[model samples]
Target: MIEGPYFVLVVLGALWCGVAAGVFVAFSTLVMRGLGALPAARGIAAMNSINVAAMTPAFMVVFMGAALLCAVIAVVTFVLWPEPGTVELLVGCVLYLAGSFGVTVVANIPRNDALAKLAGDEDSERSAAYWRRYLSEWTLWNHVRGGAALAASAAFVLSLT
Candidate 1:
């Protein structure tokens, strides 16, 4: 049961990601809907900043930790998974790490980079343009995040196996 302390990490990482997935789905959806109503970059910028600030710490921890943890889980599973629904849980874990987390780090982070450049001081065309473009593109990624998270959540359920 202890050859792989990694599985413990994997389960920890999975639960961590699972929580993040839930938060991402809800928050990103709000950002998406916010796009239609927020005509200013300031509003969008505020939302983005707050969200990033709130998310960065946990995301950094889990993103760095997941691979090591999951790999251990894979090894442990290969040797000693309980054999009921282990496969489902493992696959679900893979999907979240591969799909949802991938989208957040790859797709969303870059957009946040772009968004961070926009200034919120007074009315400005560049800011508006940035907000408009940012909202549209960001929302697409948000949907992807939400979908992937839902899939991951389903995978988390497999832990019962």
Candidate 2:
């Protein structure tokens, strides 16, 4: 069984993953919905502002820190434990790294970037069209990210038990 500092790391990592998951959940549950209900250009503008504002140091410390911790947990678990014991940790690690972090980098960030470049005009038909696409596409990927985070959190916790 995991003990000492490694155990603490595992728990902290899971907690961070859980926190990250909660942020995504909030976005999926209400934030996006609220934005979507606004006029398209307004919605898009709001989202662009949110995307820009979300890059604060506090958010990155949790988001990227969770990814880092997951990597560390996977490596340490693999080295310290046998097959079955390490399995969940590795699974959690992969989900966080590839599913959560990768999707954010590969899919969501690009979408946010594209949205940022859009002109913020409430009456612009083009803005409306872009908002339609962004709302659907971005939210879909966010669900993936949130689900992966929750699953990774569960996996890490399971590994400890």
lDDT for model 1, on a 0 to 1 scale? 0.64
lDDT of each: 0.64, 0.89
Candidate 1: give its CA RMSD in angstroms.
4.0
Q: Candidate 2 at 84: error in angstroms?
A: 5.2
Candidate 2 Cα deviation (angstroms), residue 12: 0.6
Q: With candidate 1 superimposed using the best TM-score fit, by how many Å does residue 76's alpha carbon deviate from the native?
A: 2.8
Over 4 Å off, model 2: 120-122
Error of 1 at 27 (Å): 0.5
Q: Show pairs that collide, candidate 2.
A: none
Off by over 4 Å in 1: 1-15, 55-72, 79-84, 120-122
Candidate with the greatest TM-score versus the true structure? 2
Model 2 TM-score on a 0 to 1 scale: 0.95
- Over 19-131, each residue of candidate 2 has an lDDT whose tens digit, in order, gives 99999989988999999999887888788888878889999998999999998888898787784547888889999999999999999999898887785464678778888
